[model samples]
Every structure is written in structure tokens, then in C-alpha cells.
Target: MKTANEKKNKMTTSEKTSKYLMPNFGVRDFVVSGGKGSWLFDDKGEKYLDFGAGIAVTCLGHAHPRWAKAVAKQAAEIAHCSNLYMTRQQADLAEKLVEKLGPGKMFFCNSGTEANEALIKAARLYGKKVTGAEGKKFRIVSAIDGFHGRTLGALAATAQEKIQKGFAPILQGFSYAKYNDLKSFEEQMGDDVAAILIEPVQGESGVTPADPKFLKGLKALCKKHGALLLFDEVQCGIGRGGAFLTSQKMGVKPDGVSLAKGLGGGFPIGAVWLAKPVQDIFTPGTHGTTFGGNPLACAAALETLNVIEKEKLCENASKMGERLGRGLEKIAKKYPGKIRLTRGVGLMRAVLFTEQYPNAAVCKKLRENKLILIPAGCNALRFLPPLNVKASEVDKALNIFEKTIERL
Candidate 1:
């Protein structure tokens, strides 16, 4: 008794989703339509507890009222504009970022990868200018298992070969070193090294936190070698690791910080903060973007920052992250050989299955149960809930998680 439109709407979304999308990325069979607070709703009206939060993009929770209002107002005013002209939204956002981040300049872009790419370019330019390496000595030292981006420059900097296999003949100037190993880093810190880019916590590598001593040692090494120390905070910054900037928590300042993911509260935007010394790496005509700081995205980013500060979401994140980690530890203790480790900070955490490597099947089953979690690193699961998620919500998620773990 259904009409054509009604029938079309009633049809299973996975049928169409699998048929239409590119085959490169794997997707679960969830057709999400709307979101609010810390929950997402599917097209079929099924409710989902969102712990992923779009890979840490919705930091203030999905569709925060103030953020939504800001986006709506900006959309009504103007959505797209080029960097050729002066934009108040972009200017104001940059000023706020520099003020909070301290003594640094900013360049707006569209995603984490773009932000990283810009950082890479800036480092190479610095190498060429200061190190007297015109073209030959432009190599950069990066941590193994680091995830920069998919673009040529960023991917070249990324240390994972599985992601870089077919994208062979990647852009040059990237050397890999052991993460949290000062001796390994020291061995690689040579004259040709342009910069040493690293993530404070390796999110894609199962939320592994870098050692503080190692980071400080690397900072000193970079200074000794005249190489810029760049922090790829795309996944760990904007309060992802419980702090505005992860380096601040470690008490070691990097020359540059690349950020995105959580910056725009689900809106598309990336920002790179450079210290005062390297501020002029990209002159006016050297680099630009068409829609990087479009009014809509800036509005969303501004609200996200304000909400995180005013709502004390960072503090909430720290408290809840500890709670989640403790609960996960109990789970790990119950299942001795099956669970290997738990690493994370704030709201970012991961648990690895010891039995198998990169157990996508476990995640597949979790998705089937509608619990919604993804595997990290070689054999782990990541939990990246919104920063403002309530303790009660964590309890609910833990219940579902316990059930799922028991089945596993």
C-alpha cells in the first residue's frame, strides 16, 4: 500500500549506499540522517550512540544549538569567498587562534590533509632558505606509524606502506624513525633533514601517546640539527587529547602545529599555526584557497572553540576519558590474553585485541549490533566521543560495550 516515494524512502539504505560510493573506503550499513547531543539517527529512524563523533570532528556534540545557529546565520550572509579579498570571519578566527595559541600565525585550509600539506611545504621552504638546501637536501624525518594525510606531500610524510602501496612513487623527502625512541631519532637527525613531523599521540596507531622525554629530546635534536619540529595535531589537537594543544601538556613547543578534525565542529576547515619566526613562509601570492575559510565553516569553528571553553568540555573530556580507560582496563583484565593494551587521553582511547592483527571482523560485529566503533592500528578499537558527552551517556555506552566485549 506504499506510494513510489514512500517505497523509495522505505527501501534499505545499504542497498543504495553500497552501489553508489567509491570502493576505496569501507563503510558500515548505517544510513544516518540527523544528530543531536551525543547521538545520531539513521534514515530508518534507528537511534545510534555516537562515540566516534565523525572521527573527532563534532567536538561540542552533534548539532550544538549555538553552533547550528552560527552556521545558519553565516549561510544566510555568505557561504563561499576567495582569499583574494579581506574576510572578517577569517580574520577574526585567525586573530582568536593566534591569541589562544600564542605568538603564532595561521593559514586556513579545508581538511587535516591540507593543513599537513601546508606544513610540509613550509618546512621544505624553510630548509631551502635557511639550510641552503635548494632541492637536494629537502628530506624530512617523520615518526613511524604516523598518519599525516592522503595527499602526495602528506602521504609521503606518512609512514604506513599499506596505505601508500598503490599510490607508489610518492613525493620525496620523508625518512621514518621509531616512535618514542630518542636513539633512533638521533640516528636519523642528519644535515639533510628539513623537519621532523610527528603526532603527539598516534591516533591512527591505536592512540599511542608519545613519551615526553622522547619529545623533549627530539625538540633539542631538531634545534641542534636546525630542523623544524612540526606537530601533526590533526587528530589530537583542538582538545582531542584533553588539551587545546598536546605539545602544551608535554611542555615542549613545536615550531608548527597542523590542525583540523575537531576545529569546525563537523564543518570543513583546517588551520596551521606557525611560530613568529616562520610566519612569513607563505607570502600573499605564494599559496591560497578558494573555500578554506568560507563564512559558514568559520562560524562553526568559532562556536566550537567558544563552546569547548565556556562549557568546560575539555575538563569533562579529561574526567570521562579517565573513567572510560579505567572501565576498559577492567574489561581487559577479565580477558587476559585476548586484550593487549589501552592507550588514550581525554576522550580519545583505543583497545587492541591480542588474538588477531587488525581484526575488522570484531568491528563488523560491533556495527551489526549497532554499537558503532572502529578498529585502530593493527588490532584495536577506538572510542572518540564528543567532548561534552555526559557521564550518563558514558554509562550507556559502557553497557553496550560490555555486551559487545562479552560476545567477542
Candidate 2:
């Protein structure tokens, strides 16, 4: 008898996806049917270990009982109302986020790009307030090879040529600095520079972490130049980096921080937290979102936070990250020249490869072997397992990785 997945697979590829979805993404072969903690099942009932965690969004993992219940319950009661009115769930979520991060007022949005756009607007407003002129002191400095988002403002802030291609005349007032190089950043700073935006861990640029000293120095520089420091924690926050905020773990504070990805577990939500100095910058009519801070999203986020705290997932992430790192180091040692380096914090990790090794091919093979990983920039493979992943799952993934490397 043909299984349900078999029947579904019988449909042509074009019929399955080409009709409705845009052709931007390269659609994979199999159709995902369902997922559980640390695992995903395709339409054919074949299971694969989930190390990518839906590109680091599903921090608590798939089909989490608590998150599911909270989202469903909230949806049943009330899903959304325009931001004109306040909801208890939104207030609760904002309070929780403030408690995790330092004193700040939050503006809720629907995605990371929106969060970052808000940060940009806040910085621009701060600049206008300081200089008593619009467009003066509004230039924002961002690091090269950093990925912010696809929106026009965020895209302009992003320094990659490939991302900026075809999006000409990108919103002005943006400049680029080299990551991890304080001097490169210093050269860009001036009286007109309003903000320095960067990711604590450069998730898209091969999981490169910002040095503690560099972050501290950057904070000092921002203070000296009277500019705001914006940390894009869209991918590294929400306990994925073993801290509520990666900057918290690094002992550095920024004037504004953007968060999304894992913040809502599986649901869509985004937020920007502004420190006391800039919290009041966005007064009425300054900025707003229609579905942001809606009851359903907040309920999901609140429950996600609750689960992270109750399960001690942050501690688990630290422990598992250490174990995963040690295992990767061992593998790197075994394959000396082929494996260039391994870098990251908590579970947000990457293994870079030598030019001779094809990262894309190896990643494809790993997927064939039922182990999923994210292909990061700079010829690196990223491993973003769930915070609550077990040691045995790590071992299993390592075993598959070793076999693949051996074959190479």
C-alpha cells in the first residue's frame, strides 16, 4: 500500500511548489510533514535530526507542548487587535523582556527586519535630538560581512555586495567597518555618526563571535562619540547563545538591541529594546505596527520565555555547547587541514573548511545522511541545535559528521 507521503510525492515538483510560492528559495526535495524535539519527519515518514533548529528560530524545538498550548489558547481567546489598544499579554511580554535585558522600553514588531528598522529610526531621532538638525549626525556604521535583513533600510545597513545587488540607491546614511577590528570602526566614527550597529555573534558571517574587549571598547567609543550602540541579537539572543542576550554574557550593554528569531518560539514576533536614554524617543505617531504586540504572538513568546526559565534551557545550552565544541575540536584534529577552524558561543557554532573541501557538497551529504545543518558564509557549516538537545543527539550528529568527513 502506498503511504500518504508516497502519494504526495507522486505530484510533480512544479505542482508541489512552483505554482504558489515565489522562486526565490531553492526548494529542497522532500516535504516536511511534522517535527518533534530535535527531530523532523518528512512526508515519507523519514526522520532527520534537526541541528539547524529552523535556522535558529525554533530554540525550544518543534512541537513544544507548552508553547503549542499557549498559542492555541490565545488564538481561541483573541488573536489580534490593532496597537491602538493594549493587551495584557503584550504588557506581560514586554515586562519579561525588560527583566531579561536591562532597563528599556520595547517596541514590538513582526520580524527581525522591523525590529532593526525601528532601531535605525530611534538612532536617527536621537541624532536629530542631539544635533538639532535632521540628517546631520545620522550616518550609521555597520560591519562588513554582517547580515541584518532584506528590507531596504536593513539591506542598506548590511554591507554585503551580493545582498545589495539590484537594490540600488539604498537608503543613505550607512557606512561599513570591518568586523573584530576596532581601528576600522574608529576610522568611521565622526561627529556625524549617530549609531554603531553590529551583531554580538556574526551569525551569517560564519558564527564569528565579537571579542569581549572589542565589544567593551566599542561601547566606550559610542559613548565618546555620543552615538548609540545597537546590537542585532536577532539570531543570537533568546538563550540560543546561553544567555537571554549575548551582550549580557559578554558583559557589554548597548543603547538599543533588536531581537526576533527564537523570541516567539515558532510564532512570528520581533522587538527593539531601547535604554533609558533613548526609550522615550519614540513618542506617539513616531512609529507603530498593526499586528505587532498582538495577543497571540505575545502569548506564545511569554510561554516560550516561561519554558526557557522553567527548563533551565540556558544552562543546558552552555553545557551542551561545551560538549559539542569539544567533540568538534576532536574531529578537526582528526582532519587537520580539511577542517580549518571551529568557532561560536553556546550552541551557535560553525566549522570552517579549507578551500579544497566543498562546504556545499558536504552539507548536502549531511542532509542525505539525515543530519541537517545550515550553510553559513565563508565556506562554513553551522550547527544550531536546540537549547534542550540531549548529549546523545550531539553524539549522533557527530558520528554522522565524522563518517561524512572520512568519506571526503
Candidate 3:
């Protein structure tokens, strides 16, 4: 086999990826070699402090020992087995999640979109069974600018029109309610509303956290209207936003929670956690997934949880997130005309720029410097560094961020 430099010179990374992969995602054209902690190394040996963490997926940093061991051990033992027969790893992982959530059950999947898809299904099923609200009454109410996923069911719940465009005749029975506005949500709440789906921190539309008042009030409204409250914790859960369950810190117990991203510490895993009563809604064969709780994924997730517990990533996320936020605020104040707002929780943060300095431009600049980031909404710069991103790394990132903003 030709060496990297020899091969890199012959065929660009972009060439290989574009020729092989689907065009659904915007690939950065960087052939990543490896990562350690908060940084990633390209095949060219260029170092980049990854602030995006693969879009907020690697919470415990990269290539950690725990994860490496879990993957290795599980692979050697049993990489994958169908959900037909019960697997020990699967049972142990489920039991562990049950213990963590307390009086809840778990349905494993492989992506946030799939988790949301399952949650949507369960809510409709509950509506049909419990409330006797069949086809017409099984409507989902989601907040504007909220991103559930790209699957048809979750896509229909997504608020952004650009994503849903051309996918004509979307999944029906979904309604949009104004985010952070209870009056709008109240108006939308009715017998037809089977569930209200929301993100604790809107990761895609910039990291705008849901107000406690809106969350608490949404729960009350759900209860009053006999609708289940679903929290799309895909981006905020598993110590991303300073808590295991961010809604819990606000003292609200949602009936359903969809999680992915960091759940498997970079491995593909998504879970829909259900409250006690809501747990029993799905009987055998009622819902299923092929790769949801396979031994490889379960082992990775089990160890990911352990690493979070042992390393106290939640505490680290809180401290680093505050430091990052404060630094961003200072930058925003210094460049008030360009930097419009900075909003986020823990490591999940976004810096919205004035229309004069577009978010896409800022994102492009960041990527040019080999820094990986993503644009949220139309004018927001999203950042989701690893939970273990150090103070030194944070400081360096701030400098890079400042330089990037100054150029604008």
C-alpha cells in the first residue's frame, strides 16, 4: 500500500470521499488519522483542536482508554448478535440505564433521528391506546427552530423549511408552536396534541436553551391536555449541558427523552428513555431495531457512562462551558457590532453574528484554519468541544476564535 503522503499527493481526500460517500453531508475534505483528548490529527500530520467533537458526539474526549478497551473487549467477545436472542451485554446495559434514570425503560437505536422517530411512534401509540386519540388526534407539537432529525417523522417535526423542502407530502399530524413562548404553546395544546417534543438546548438552531418557565409550563400544559412531554436531549444529555438530564435540573420530569450524540462516546447509539408509565407502552415486537443494542454498542455505551461517572465530565462541562461562555461574552462585547449573541449550556454553545458578518462566512474561516465547527440556523456559529477540553485548550481556542471574529 502506498504511504499517506504518496497517496495524498496522488488523490485528494475530497476525491476519495466524494467518489465513495453520499452527498447528504458536507464533508470537510480532511482525512482524519486519529484523535487524543480534545484534538484531532489529519493524515497530513496537521493538528486541530476539534471544537465540534463530531457534532457533539465525543463527550469524553477522543480515543480514551476506557472506550478503546470497551471496543476491543466487546469485539473479541461478541461484536454483534441479533435482538432475537437476549444478549448479556444488552441486558446489562439496559439495567444500567434503568438504574440511572430510575423507573424508566430504554429502547436503543443508532442515531438521534432514529431515537426521535421511535419516540414519535410511541407517543402516537399511547395516544391511540390510552387517550383513544387515533389518527386525527395523534398530532405532535414542536417548537420553532427545533431540530429533531431528518427522518420522515422527525423531519416533519423539524421546524426548518429548508430541510423539509422537496420532501413534499411530509408526515402529517405535526404542528409548530413558538419556542420560548408559552402563549403560543398553550394555544396549540389541545385534545389532538398527543405530545410536545422539544430540545433542552436547541443544538442546531444555535444553542438556545429552553427557559425554565417554558419547560415547567410545557409539562403542566401536557398534563392538562393529556399529552406526553418529550425532551430531545440528543445534544444536551450525557453530561453535555451540565447534567445527565438537563430537564431534571430544572425540576421537570418529561414523559419521554430521546438521546444520541455522546451517549456512546462517538460510537453510533441512540436511546429513547421513557418514564415509568410510558415505559410499558411498547410490548414485544411493538418496536424494534437491528443495531440498537448490539454488544459492541452496548459495551461502548456502558463504559462511556462509567467514564463520565468516574471523570466527572458533567462538572468539567459546567466549568469549561462557563469559562467558554464568559470568554465568548467578552468577545461579543468587544465586537458587539459583529458578534450579536452567545447562548449555550455546558459545551454546547453558539455565537450568533450580525447579518453583516454571516455565520457561514465565520464557519468557513474557522474551517480554513483546520478548526472543525458547524453553523447553526442562519447566523449562528456552533461549538461543541469535548467535555474534557482543558483550560489551556479552551484559552487557545478563544484566541483562534478571536482571530476568526476579528477578521470579520
Candidate 4:
């Protein structure tokens, strides 16, 4: 039997969600009320080490003082206005991103999906420019297992059959190629190809990092075919991959990059950076967003950048990522039959479980042990702790993870 208070709380939360919200996402029963640093607290005051980091969205962790203060201050001053005018926040944020990304222009939007859509549109315009016609060279080649976004344009670029199943007649002119295979991509690189878009570190299918040589080969291929090389760094950018952008660490210079997951820490803000050659594709009337780079969103993103640089969070991500990788490797050794291998760079790491131990089962058991993880593909578990996570926190998470595996 449940108390009246528990019944009332249920009515206000899960029950209400069941009645009102759409049945799209798999809703967790745990009601998260607050978080700090690298931990989350449910409404019942239960603390859990948050290794998922909101699927790599919260790069600075739950609530950083600088980020919160900047958001609050900008919200009080001016939350939003039409893109008809400019704000200091937008100007500063754009300038910072351009500097960090190396000679590019930034377009702001509301989420990663929107950022990819903008990139897709950019590819189309570039294609038109290359072939001197609207649809002459407008095909896009993405990886087979790549997960771009749910929006139609981004979805079309995503080659997953399961994701594209119900949505019939996906946008046309999109093709698939084997990821990290130079020859496979070359087979698809016809004159009709406009862009070769890929995630330098594929996050959803699994945290699979691209081979550096393969990325360089794609850039050469794009140059030869007059097609743009775009990188979808939404999940692996912004210090999460031990660098400002994972592609940068990989030493590949792409024509465009899509970013969003951690761009504003926890706030919703998406951005696309286009290199100088194709920056002029989107003229004044081509594209725009009303709430994309508003004062509050820009402020939050700017403060996130400020904190990452000042605290050397990128270096921290690299250092702690090594520690976490080593720990996972040890665990893999202990359970060699059950665990396959660990993949990914920096904070964007995943452990591949053998069929004997499924990902969903391990994830559920971890949650019960007060540790949060994200499931990827069929048998991979993602561990995306905050970039600024303390060493002690990493050790604690590793302890919990090993113990959980032991019990299993």
C-alpha cells in the first residue's frame, strides 16, 4: 500500500506525464529534481553518479556557478528578440566559436537536429554552386550506422533502417557508405555527390571514432569531387573529445561542422560552422532562426566556453579519459567472455558487452547501483561524464561499475 503523499506526487509527475505527454521516448520512472557537478538527485533525494551527462549534453555538469549566473543575468536583461536585430551576446559567442574552430562563420539554431539541417541545406547550395544547377550534384553520402538527427533532412542523411522505417519516402538523394573505409566511400563519390557528411566520432550506434587517415582521405575525395566535407560533431565536440572539436584532434580540416549537444552546457543551442569557401552560400534571405542565438542562449554558451578554457577542461577530459579507459580495460580483462572491448576517445566512451550480457540489462543494474549510463546500439553502454569531472569522481564511478559487473 502507498501513502497519500506518494499518490499525490505520482499524480503530479509520472501519472501526469502518462496522461499528457507523447509516448515517444522511454520515460524513466526516477524523477530527477536537481543535480550538481557530476551527480543527480531524484525527487526522493537519492543521489546517482551521472555518467550519461544527459547523453553528452551537460559538458560542464549539472549546475556550474558561472553558467547559471550568466544565464540568469541575460534572462533578466533580455531573453529574446527577433533575429531582425543583433545582440552583444550573439556577436561575442559567434566570434569565440569562429576563433576556436579556425576561420569559419557560425550559424545558430535551437538543437543538434536543426544544426544538421542547416548543414544539409548548405550542402545543397554548395552542390548547386559546383554543378551550376539546382539538383545536378546534390547527393549526400553518409556512413551506414551514422545517426544524424530525427528531422526529415537530417533523418535522410542518417542511414539507419530502423529509424527511417515508419517515415516513408525519406528525403531523396541520400546514400550510404561504409564508415572508415576509404575505398567504400570512393565507390559512392560520383559527380552527383554534393557532400560527404559524417560523425568523426559516431555516438548513437556506438562511440566509434573514425580513423584519422580515413578522415583525411575523405577530405581529399571531397576536394577531388568538388563536394563539401562536413562533420557532425554534435555529440563529440566541445571538450568532450579531449579537444575543442574531435575533428581538430583528428587533424582533419572539414568544410563544415555541426554542433549542439554541449554548446550551451544544458541550455538548448545549436550551431553550424562553415569554412570560408562555402560561407557565402547562405545569403540574407536563405535561412534564419528566431530563438537560436538569443541573449540567454548565447550567454549560456559563452560562459560554457569561458569556463572550459579557464579551467582547462579539455586537458582534464583527455587526462581523465585515459584513466576511465584503463579502468574499463581492466574490467574487460576480468570478464573477458562477457565484455568485448572499449571504444571512443575522451569523455565519449562506450563498453561493448557480449551477447551473454546485454546492454539494457547492465544499464538497469547500474541504475539500481546508483550509477547512470546510456545505451548505444544493441550491446554498447556509453559513459559520458562531465569534462570537468574530478579524479575522485572517476574512481568512484569505476568502483561502482566494476562492482556492478562483479555482481552480474
Say which candidate scores most in TM-score. 4
TM-score of 2: 0.96
Better-scoring candidate (lDDT), 3 or 4: 4
RMSD each, Å: 2.4, 2.9, 2.7, 2.4
Pairs of residues at least 3 apart in sequence or in different chains that clash in candidate 2? none
Candidate 3 RMSD to the correct structure: 2.7
Tens-place lDDT digits, model 3, residues 70-174? 899999999888788788877888898788776889999999999999999999998998756578559999989999999899999998898899898999898
Model 2 C-alpha lDDT per residue in residues 270-364, reported as the tens digit of each score: 99999987899998898989999899999999999999999999999989998999999999999987899898999999999999987888898
What global local distance difference test value does model 1 have? Answer: 0.85
C-alpha lDDT score of every prediction, in listed order: 0.85, 0.93, 0.88, 0.93
> Could you tell me which 10 consecutive residues in candidate 3 have the lowest summed lDDT?
128-137
Give the per-residue lDDT of model 4 (tens digit) for 79-105: 999799989999999999999998879
lDDT of 3: 0.88
Query: Which of candidates 1 and 3 reaches a greater lDDT?
Result: 3
The candidates, ranked best first by lDDT, are: 4, 2, 3, 1
Residue 399 lDDT in model 3? Answer: 89
